[model samples]
Target: MQNVLQYLPQLLGAAFKYTIPIAVISFVIGIVIALITALIRISNKRGVMLVVKAIFRFYVWIFRTTPLLVQLFIVYFGLPYLKIAGIAPDGIKLVPFTAGILTFSLNTGAYCSETIRAAIIAIPKGQWEAASTLGMTRRQALQRIILPQALRTSVPPLANSFISLVKDTSLAASITIIELFEVSQQIAAANFQPLLMYSLVALIYAVFCTVLTFIQGYLEKITSRYTIA
Candidate 1:
């Protein structure tokens, strides 16, 4: 009990410094990637775009189908060996933090792209037509009208994804990132109280996720208000 209290700050500190930051940064980047991918995949043009769409589809498929841990290992460990000649004779090598961010962003983006795409598709075709009738270009319709509605509908799922991402940041420990879970592991090793330390960490994660859940509810309420007649 005394030891746990003593080390509580350290555990929280790790979360503030590494865990939260990693998740926030990764999720932000992931959202951008997801929005772009979703937009591109749904675009009507089909010239060179066919090639681009296929590439994005394969990327999403590969990330969604593979284990995240394997993805981390590939980014952090395997990439260093793939020599790239002039681009990089020694291949691509990323620091632990960079590797974690890269993997998490891409993985989350792949999943969130599907979520966003579904949300966009859920918008009524009449909505698009309405925007067009207002003398709006497709780009203007998407930017000014379509995306706002999609965002409202997508908020819950996207928030859920963000919460899951917060928990998943613990996996950064596997690659020597020394995040929240790793901090707990280190303390447990020292105190020889693995059960207590693990439980404590889990509680922290639950707390963080609970806060996110509340935020999700709040957002859902706000977004749904205009729909309620």
Candidate 2:
């Protein structure tokens, strides 16, 4: 207990340093991949749409069905076994940070793809007709008219996903990345005060998620003005 209290600052600082990058990078890359996936899902070409849907569906099925911890293990541990023989070289394996970023990004992308696809589909047919009447091509209408509205519609869900990613970052610790929960675990193990350390970690996560909730509400209010519904 005394040791945990004494080292609180160091523990917290290390945790935040390790966790923030995972959350931010994952969210950004995930959103971009999701947007592209959504665009493909909504395209007029049947072949393109089918391919995109299959990719997204498979991604979502795999990630959602498997435990995230196992996924991280495969990325950090299993990949080395399948590396390109001696060409890949030793010590060039995925680092904890790389594993955190890659796994989180892929996991978030699976969910975000669905949210984005729904948003794009929800765009009003009249909006498309209006854009075409103005001499816009389908691609131009999607880019100029449909996507913006879909983005607004997607905001709340995207915010929720960001919040979830922020908390899930603790899973990175399982791969030896010293994220919040991992730091707390170390503190508790050293001091024999697991309850106190874990409680603090939980509190920190709750506060962060709470802030995200407020931001989501504010964005929803601002975007509501532009919403077709």
Candidate 3:
């Protein structure tokens, strides 16, 4: 018990150092990518849009199907090999922190795009028609009427995604990011108390997820206030 307490501050500090930054940066960029992909997937254009949609579908498929650890390995270990093929510069290096953020963002973006797309689709056709009748352009209608409602509906799913991303950030340790879980492993290695160390790590993650859940509930209430239901 004393040993566990002794390591608590260091583990928690390392979590704040690496885990939170990776999750926040990745999730923010992921939201941007998801919004863009969702919009592109819904476009009505024929040739260009078809090609774009196909590309994004392939991207989402690849990320969703592969293990994230493999993805991280590819980014961290494989990318630098491009120099050997005369593609990238010889000096190119993929830092663990940068690679971790990039991998997590791409993975989260692929999954969240579908959630956002479905939310956008769920908005009634009547709302678009109503906006059109009011002399609104397609962009205007989407910006004013459809998107707000879609965002409201999207809150729950996106919140879940963010929570999942927080947990997934631990996987960054596989590539030497030295996050919360990695810190636990280090402590356990020295003390020979894997069970106790891991239990503390799990408890910290549960606390983070629980806080996110409360925030999710609060946001749901705020978004629901103006909703008809």
Candidate 4:
């Protein structure tokens, strides 16, 4: 306990340095991908719908089926093999950070797409009709009316995704990325105090996730005001 307290600042500082960028960038890009996939999942055109659905289905299948560590290894260390033979004579210089972002983003995108699709569908058809009557196109109605409501309904799930991503960032360490968990591992190895060091790591994650929960709750409260009864 005393040793953990002594090393808390160092562990936390390293953890923050590694986790924050991975979480934020992955969440943002993952949300964007999920939004596009959700739109495809809901679209009406046969050609557009078929292609998008196929793409997303394959994408989600591949990512969800594999362990995240395998994904990171392939992206960070395996891509430059036969896949990119002509593109560059040299192998890909896969950075750990880039690998971390790619893995986290793709992983989160699959789950969040379903969350987003459900949210959009949950919106009332009356809202769409109201928007059309007010001189809005389908796109406009989706942008101005349906999406806003969907966002409110989507908050809790989206928050869960973000929280998961935060913890998942620790997997970056497996690929030589010096994230919080990796730092904890190194400290534990040196001090031979695995239990104490990991407890601190868990505490840090809990604190961050708790803060996100509060923010999500507050946002949900605000968004509820605008939700159609």
Candidate 4 lDDT for residue 46 = 88
Per residue, candidate 3 scores C-alpha lDDT tens digits across 1-229 of 8869898899889889999889989999999999998988888889877999999889889999999999999999888766654556673578999999999999999999999999999999999999999999989998999988998889999999999999999998899988999999988999999999999999999999899999999999988897656
Give TM per candidate: 0.97, 0.89, 0.95, 0.92
Best candidate per lDDT, number? Answer: 1
What is the alpha-carbon RMSD of candidate 4 to the true structure?
1.9
- Per-residue lDDT for 12 in model 1? 94
Minimum summed lDDT over a 10-residue window in model 1 is located at 1-10
Itemize residue pairs with steric clashes in candidate 3.
none
Residue 114 alpha-carbon offset, candidate 2, angstroms: 0.4
Candidate 4 lDDT, tens digit per residue, 164-204?
89988888888898888888999899999998899988999
**Against the hidden true structure, what lDDT does model 2 obtain?**
0.84
Ordered from best to worst TM-score, the candidate numbers read 1, 3, 4, 2
Measured with C-alpha atoms, the lDDT of residue 46 in candidate 1 is: 81
Tens digit of lDDT per residue, candidate 2, span 148-193?
Answer: 8888889988998999999899988889998888888887888788
**Cα RMSD, model 2:** 2.7
- Superposed model 1: Cα runs more than 4 Å off: none
The superposed Cα distance between candidate 2 and the true structure at residue 227, in angstroms, equals 5.7
Off by over 4 Å in 4: 89-91, 227-229
Model 2 segments more than 4 A misplaced:
1-5, 46-53, 85-92, 227-229
Candidate 1 TM-score versus the reference: 0.97
Best by TM-score: 1
